[model samples]
Target chain A: MAEHTILVVEDDSTVRELLKYRLGKHYEVYTATNGKEALDQIEETIPDLIISDIMMPKMDGFALQSALQADKNTRVIPFIFLTARADEEARQQGERKGVDDYITKPFDMETLLSRVERLLERIDMFQNQLDAEIGRDFSNRLLPDHTPDIDGYELDFHSESRQQGGGDLFDWTETEKGTYFLTIGDVMGKGLRAKFYAFSFLSYVRGTLHTLLEESTSPAALMGELNDMLLNDDVLEDTFATFLLFHWDPHAHTVTYANAGHCRPVLMTPDGATVHEHSDLILGLEEDITFSEVSLDLDPGTALLSYTDGLTEQHTQEGGMLGEDGVRDLAVDAYDDASSIQALLDGVLSQSASDSFEDDLLVVWLKRLAE
Target chain B: MSFDAETASSETVIIHVGEALDFRNADDFKATFQEHVDEGVRQFILNFSDTEVLDSTGLGSIFSLYRAISPDDGKVAFADVSEPVQVVVQLTRTYKVFRQFPSVEAAREAFAE
Candidate 1:
């Protein structure tokens, strides 16, 4: 039925044929005489499950697994090892290598079949839960969480995920000194694997940035320090993000901010829409990259919308993306929509074709409402 | 989302990117370029004639290659950048670091070795 794909890699033709004969009924079966052959077969069809024999002619199952793990594309294919000698040491070696499951030489067909089915179910279930998790993270991280309840200011944020977890992250922290800091970042990547990378990056930011934020309120200076931290860190060596950090000074009615290669924010005033065009390089690029901390004093009846590219990159009915100018205009138009930023976001997002956005739409709207 | 590289010389390489360069293929893009870097190609010229989408992640990948080739005074340039890719380059101001040319032939001429 081609419902699923199963790859069987065994040096012995008899075992390979038996697996193909049985698993072929429920799945599209592919057989390889050895681990090297399995890899060659994998280039054509990526199977949902792989059953590999540890002992092979050219390459062993362990070596094949290490090869698969080396590649980002084939890293997560559910792998099982089959061996004749099922000793404790062998099991430990497989465990250390991240083998999903193992079957001994004298294994039951029903046991192997059930294990295969259950593992596939778990994989699918995890995929489904990822959607729900992203939704929860969107709600949990995006607004009203660490946001300060400052006087004379209205702040709101929201995210519409494409359900792909495109790594749009937002966080805010009010320090012990009452210095309010807000940050919006987008980790550069797409899809599930990137989601994990994004999650780690975001968590590290949430965990580590607060202490760093306490050391300096100058957004640009703090950004340089963050750059150094990222450059020196091992886990985030390959990761990159476009981050905008904002410091809202309620007493001065001003917002001081620094941009690390993020999209320009659209500002709405009585005159017209003004775009913040200045920005430094994105994070994790180079050492000693400096960002400028620019301060803007707010006026009554003013609104500023800072967002990731998702807002502007939405496709229109004409198959064109809404560019920077389009976003500025729409944001200005949305500013007059209603009293609520959520309504404004609803209005802005309604511009997309069929109300379906292709990426994660994230925005942090700051409004100085009219007196 | 995909890349093809042409060898102009042992020191220079021209990279052709198509349609999209976003988070989906940023790592692949970097890895692809790194292979050329390993092969002693220090100069890179990106041909983005067919590029329509260039996101922050894609820029980061380009930056990665830039960081790799920069220590030895290596260079990266853009030729025939599409409008969308132009938007990203302008916004990030990466053009300040990486130079641009009108065409791949021009880039090759600039790096003729």
Candidate 2:
């Protein structure tokens, strides 16, 4: 285990020496005479905890706490205030400023030590919880690390959620017959609840796709079944998802796709770009709704891109959205520039007004290679 | 989110919602709407003219309010829905669940029937 470091700030030499002597056995101790000295020490090496005195020259404990809180780097470190004034007002002020603990002067040594130990343990517990939440988020929204190699085609896929765990999901898999099934979905909303709904939707689709595949080859039929399943599932009544499913047949060099109120997919050819705009009602809204499918022959060197609303709905500097036209223009420009998939996505993201999106974004790009 | 409720008539109430509605304020929205429902208001006009966005959770809250009032034969309607909100309403087919009108006066007239 690494040694825990503690910084003690006090103006009184006697008290400072006493604390250093007592804490030195268990922890590596550093001392500062005032807030300014303490900040300099913090800059040198951040300690696990800080014990500060309230009344000192140059800078007081309150000033130090404010300075620490203002800085992102030192704000999370546990802080304990030491004071001579035992009045309720002083203690309340410390509490209001988010001090971890307060120890009055002439206090019991054991009491101070125990409080320090408890604060450290609590910080550890909080950190553990945060780490676990991040782990769960990453696993639930896991993206494909590498695109599956398919004959006669080059594929690229990218997705980014506005939050750590987001509502956007995408996946592609090849069945035993070598048919590729690709799906992308966006659950309506943000945060953990949306992520939960997205995960549930993905799991249901993955489990039922094979059976639906055996029953029908039409994308519309598969979408209808999926819609019914979502409506029948009691948990999904209030929530809805916009989804798109695509089936690519390598032998026939054809692509058929169905949209459930998702954004239209853009097809880029040597001539120009066209958006496939056929769509049905979003899922989980009504029962027995039929989705429509659009099929197109995959001509050599033609590329297709599908994405969620996040990309097109992003606000630009002028407070206007980069709508479908902007997305198409960017895609065409990237294609003309002979850019890689990553570069194309970068071009799309650069149009956003901010670094992060208000909604989750996803894109799937596929191009048929020349024979 | 901010909600303002006023009695438009003895049987109808207008609830004006301000700003965006999503998971952040869904529970508050539900509670505020239910309070008026318990006060014996049978008809509700949700004013969304000031509402910029409504996510699924916000829509769910509206659905919950509908479920609450439907048992009593009460009705729910929307007035002055912005263009963006209309797209969501159309895409989710939520328009089927609630009646929409051009303005508060039109919705109040519809409630009289």
Candidate 3:
């Protein structure tokens, strides 16, 4: 932790000096009598981290934390709150305010030191990842690590996050009943916060899916339960989301799907492509709303093009967008010759304004190989 | 890309919407309308003639606006909606909540009395 700077704000002269002395040995420790002093000191020399006391003479630690959060430059700095041990109120407030960590008032010196070191190290690690490996790290944490290898279908998927974070996510599981379920979901909103919410939403779906599938008879039935779950979640209740779910029955050789306010998917046959124009209201919008199911028997050489709005909403060079028709035409043209979603996307993006889309893109191509 | 509004009467405000209203611009769109709602403007007429698409997030924002003003007997309507936007509205069944008109003038007149 050499060369790392830390700001310690406490009104207690004894404890403040002690922390300065102990932490000074390993870091450049700055002292402040209160939150006001801390702000003044920070304006001169921004610290790499902050350890603050909630009780102060003037301008409490919570106020200090809010000030830092309001400033974009200091918001990323890791903050540790010093709270009275066993004070549930302080702990809950700290959690609500998104404090990095907590050091109870009676904390051991060694524990505080170790936590400081760990927090700084973690800050550095995430900084490195954010600078260079955001997309890679995002996928590693959120997306399915590997695509499933179903027996009869050759499935291909392409996913990319615009600006390193997106609301798009997908997961597939092979059930014990010998059926495969693949779903591509887009949570409402965008950017990093939405990215995290997408993870939580997907996590809940993945966790409850197996049991829900056992009880629910069809895709639409399962969708109702999913709707109930969304409405029940306090955080996700107001956020609208679109989900496209596809269930493949190997024995029946058919794919049944249910759409919840998602874009209509396109079916690429040997002759041409047709848009499956069916949908329901987006989730998190209404209660008691139901989704409808559509099933199609897949022949030997049929492929389904399912994607988020990122594909169709991409800006064309003409300053106009590539709307649904353009996307359908491009998918049809590409599926005629290319066999991979990557190739199909490459063709679609070739005419787009840039190779990188402004939104998260997820494309799931389920193709039945011609025997 | 942009959100603009003009008062048609003491109660109705017609907003000119442009391009796409997905996640990218949904917040801005809502924020603009929120300012009007805060200023006591209730009834809203959205001009969707130029909008190409409305994503879930964008639709959610509109729903939020609907919730914000509906308690005051305020209403929201779409005028000259493009086919694409119409499809999304119909698909979501939001058409039941908000009526559509052929032009901005028609929407404004419907709210007159």
Which ten residues in a row are the worst by lDDT in model 3 chain A?
A131-140
Candidate order, lDDT descending: 3, 2, 1
lDDT of 2 by residue, B1-113 (tens): 44778898988889887777777787788888888888888789999998887765677677667756776878889899987678667655567667899998899888887
The candidate scoring highest on lDDT is 3
Best by TM-score: 1
Worst 10 residues of 2 chain B by lDDT: B87-96
TM-score of each prediction:
0.76, 0.67, 0.68
Compute DockQ for each candidate against the true complex.
0.58, 0.29, 0.38
Candidate 3 chain B, run of 10 with poorest lDDT: B87-96
Q: What's the candidate order when arranged by decreasing TM-score?
A: 1, 3, 2
Give the 10-residue window scoring lowest on summed lDDT in candidate 1 chain B.
Answer: B1-10
- Candidate 2 ranges beyond 4 A from true positions: A1-142, A234-237, A337-340, A355-358, B7-13, B34-44, B55-76, B87-99
The digit string of per-residue lDDT tens for model 3 on A225-344 reads: 788888778887566678888888866889898988787899988888898887776776556777889999889888898888788778888887777788788887777565668677
Best of the candidates, DockQ: 1
Q: Per-residue CA lDDT of candidate 1, range A163-192, in tens?
A: 555677778877666667787888776654
Candidate 2: chain B TM-score equals 0.92
Error of 3 at B49 (Å): 4.7
- Model 1 regions lying over 4 Å from their true place: A1-7, A10-146, A192-199, A202-215
TM-score of every candidate's chain A: 0.69, 0.64, 0.66
For model 1, the DockQ equals 0.58
